[model samples]
Target: MKAIQYRKFGGPEVLEYVGLPDPEPRAGEVLIETTAIGVNFPDVRERMGVYNRAETQVGGVTLPQVGGLQVVGRVLNAGTEAHDHLVGRKVMALMSKGAYAQRAVARADMLVELEDDTDDVVMASVPCQGVTAFLALQVCTVLRPGESVLVHGAAGGVGNLAVQIAKVLGAATVIGTASSDTRRAFVLSRGADHAIAYDSPHWPESVLSITNGKGVDVILETVGGDVFDENFACLGMLGRCVVIGSTRGPGKPLAPRQLMAKAQTLTGVYLPSFFQRPDLIQRGLRFLKDGIGQGLIRPRVAATLPLSRAADAHAMLERREAQGVIVLDPRY
Candidate 1:
């Protein structure tokens, strides 16, 4: 089997494509012949040793590690007969790591069976980012119907989906924030009712204006630092803000008392934690699958690269060159 590995922490250059023994499925697991592998920002952060502080192995610092969280593939073999019915079935599997390979082993229950005609690349874009977006709005903070939402990094993989998911969840108005006009336009195209430039100091004023000065009912804060701080300005009474990521870096410490005035709520969402709760995982997957089937949610695949060009994939993500998800074709 061929896989991408990084023996040291650094840049995209650290990713190496090399041959390795084919992985075998263990109990409660299945072997998948990968068609498309999803490349996420966490994979880049994992490669840089940013997650090294964690005690658990979330794409570990262990040398020669394979870094990835999701893939779309076909089941080649099941470890046990209890799951034999899945053989030869197409699936989108989410795992903690080892997805950047030709053949990967994933927990049997973690795989979502897909329709035969489902596009592998498009499906590959869903498992990680899609689930995160769904969980952020649906579970992390229950978004009430007819409420308004503000999504930061609206052109990003998770951000793009958050915009659509917010609408699907019955948001009366979905406002998206992006760095450039082009990205803001893209966000508007994804069903956001409004798009504003996050880089602008007056962005909160734009949000307030769009909401008719009432402010938004929900906020998805992915870009931390100043953006996170500015979110409070437009957060409405009893608003719920979910922290999904801090791509720009962590923000200044907050005073818990700030929430006292508006009765606002703050929550954090980490996708990996949901893996332990199969019930929640199934709920999220069902929502995404149904939404896509009904033409309510669309998966955006920005580009696809071959396994050999994994480094280029990482570089594209690091530079934010892709507007949507980037997938790796291991068969290449």
Candidate 2:
């Protein structure tokens, strides 16, 4: 099998594309012939040795391990928990590791069935970003009809999905922030009612202007750091701010006094932890499937690179050159 493996923790250059022995199906796991791989930020973090502060294996540093997190493929075999129905079924999985390869072994329970008509790339985009967006707006907060939403980094993978799903969840006005005119336009085309440039210093005021001086009801904040203060400023009285990611790095410490003064809520969302709550996962998966089935959740695959070009994909993401989800096809 062909896989992109990193022998050392460093930049994109460390990710080497080479041949490797096929991974075997472990007990309670399924061996998948990967069709599509979702290139995510965590992959970059893992490659750069920032995912978890753990000791690395000497030399090869787990040579067979790959960096991708999500994959869409056909299940070839299951090692345990016999389910004849799963064999050869088209499915999408959220694997903990090893997705940047022609074959991936994922826990059977982590894989979800896909409709025949569902594009592999689209399903590949769903598991990680989809789950987070869905949980933040609907499952966790329960966005009400006529409520307003603002999604930071709204043109990126999770942000774009948040923009589209906010409307489906009954948000009356959806505002999204992107870095450029092209990205702002893309966010608006994805169903957001308002689009603001993230680089503009007064973007928060612009949100206020669009909302008629009242702030938005909900805010999906992924870009943290200096801009986090502005995000809190844009939250309406009695509004909810969901912190999803801190791509801009850690922001200033939260002040409890501010929340108390405005009677607002600040919530932190991590999808991996949400898995322990099966109810949330079940409801979220249903919402994801329905959204994809209804054409409400469209995929923005700006580029599909081969597994060998994994380094280029990382460079594109780190440089902020890609508009939407950058995917990798192992078959490519």
Candidate 3:
């Protein structure tokens, strides 16, 4: 089997496509023949040694790692203790590591059966971004029907999905922030009531205008730095803001008194924490499946690269040139 591995993290050039022994399932695990591998922003962050997570650390050192989290493939075999229900099934799963390869092992509990018509590319894309969006709406924030919501970085993988989920969850209006006219148009087409460019100095004012000065009831914030600073001013009284990622920059000062004044809630979400809660994953999968079935939520594959070109995929993601999800075809 061939896999992309990096002994020391630095940049895309650190990634090396090399041959590796086939993975075998251990007790209570299943082996999957990888078909599609999802390329996420975290993958790039992990490679650069900047992603914050416990799994990103090992033996007090985080180097020498294989970076990939989500995969869509067919079950090739199962361990003795694995449930008999999974053999030879088409499934998608979140792997602890080692998904950018021809074969990988995963805990049976993390695997979800895929419908025959479900695209492998979309399945690979959904586990991380879709689950994040779904959990943000359903768990982190208590959103009410007829309330407005705002999504930052709305043209990207998670942001795009967040906009649609906000709509499906009964948000009266969804405003998405993008960087360009093209991305703004893309966001509007996908369900955002209005799409504004984050680069504009008056973006927050635009968001307020869209909500008729009441401001948004919820905010899905993926971009931090100045964008976060601006959006914080536009959150309604008692509003909830969920911070999932900070793609822009890390350091930003906040006025705690302002949050207290409005009784706003600022929360952060990490997918691994939710992994321990299978019920959340199940609910998210149900929503994703139903949305796809009903033509309400569509996961876009921005680009597909062969497994050997994993380096190029990382390069695209790092440069922010890729929109939606970028998939790796292991068969290639």
Candidate 4:
């Protein structure tokens, strides 16, 4: 099997296209012949040795690692005790690692069957970003119809999905922030009521104007750093802000007095913890599937690359040159 592996963490230059032995399914796992793999921001972080998570000894301090989190593939083998019914099904799975390969072993419990109508590109985009957006909208905040919402980084993978989810969840108005006019147009096309350039000097005021000075009821914040301060300033009284990612790196000052005065709520959400509540994950999956089936939410895939060019894919994402989801075709 061909795979992209990084022996040491640094930059995209560290990624190497090489051959690897085929992986086998364990007792509670299934072996998937990968069709597409989703490239994400975390993959870059992990490759740069900046991913802040507990480390496990694999090969050594500089262990060779496969990069990827979500994969759309066909099930070649299923575990005896877990997912025998999944044999020969087209599905998507969330892997801990090693998805940037021709084959991957994933826990059967984590796999979701793709509808026959679902395209391979859509299947590839759904697992990580789809689940994150669904869970964030359905569980992280108390969403109400007729309430205004704002989405930061609204042109990116999870951001684009979040925009559509907010609309489907009955938000009265949806505002999204992007950095360029092209991205702003793309965000509005995806159902955002308003798209503002976060890079603009008047962005905070623009959000305020859209709400008629009332501020937004819910905020889905993807970019951290200075954007956090702006989000806080744009929040409505008693507003809820959910922080899903810190793509801009974390360093921010908060106004505690302002928060107290407005009776605001600030919450940080990590999707992995949502899995601890299986019902939430199940509900999210159902919502995503239903939305896709009904055309209430659309999966936007900006580009597809051959698996061997996984390094270039990462570079594209890190450079913010790609929009929506970028997928890798392992069969290529």
List per-prediction Cα lDDT, in the order shown: 0.90, 0.83, 0.84, 0.83
- Against the true structure, whose TM-score is highest? 1
lDDT of candidate model 3 versus the reference: 0.84
Predictions ranked by lDDT, top down? 1, 3, 2, 4
Q: Tens digits of per-residue lDDT for model 4 on 219-321?
A: 9888788787778778999999999886686656666776798899988678667655656665676677778879999988879999988889999988888
Question: TM per model?
Answer: 0.95, 0.91, 0.92, 0.91
User: What local lDDT does model 3 show for residue 331?
Assistant: 83
Candidate whose lDDT is highest? 1
State residue 34's C-alpha deviation in candidate 1, in Å.
Answer: 0.9
Off by over 4 Å in 2: 53-64
Residue-level lDDT tens digits of model 1 in 100-149:
99999999887788898988888888888988988899889998889999
Model 2 local distance difference test score: 0.83
Candidate 2 deviates by what RMSD? 3.1
| Cα TM-score of candidate 1 | 0.95
lDDT of 1: 0.90
Residue 105, model 1: lDDT of 91
Off by over 4 Å in 1: 54-59
Report clashes for each candidate as comma-separated counts: 0, 0, 0, 0
Quick one: ranking by TM-score, best first?
1, 3, 2, 4
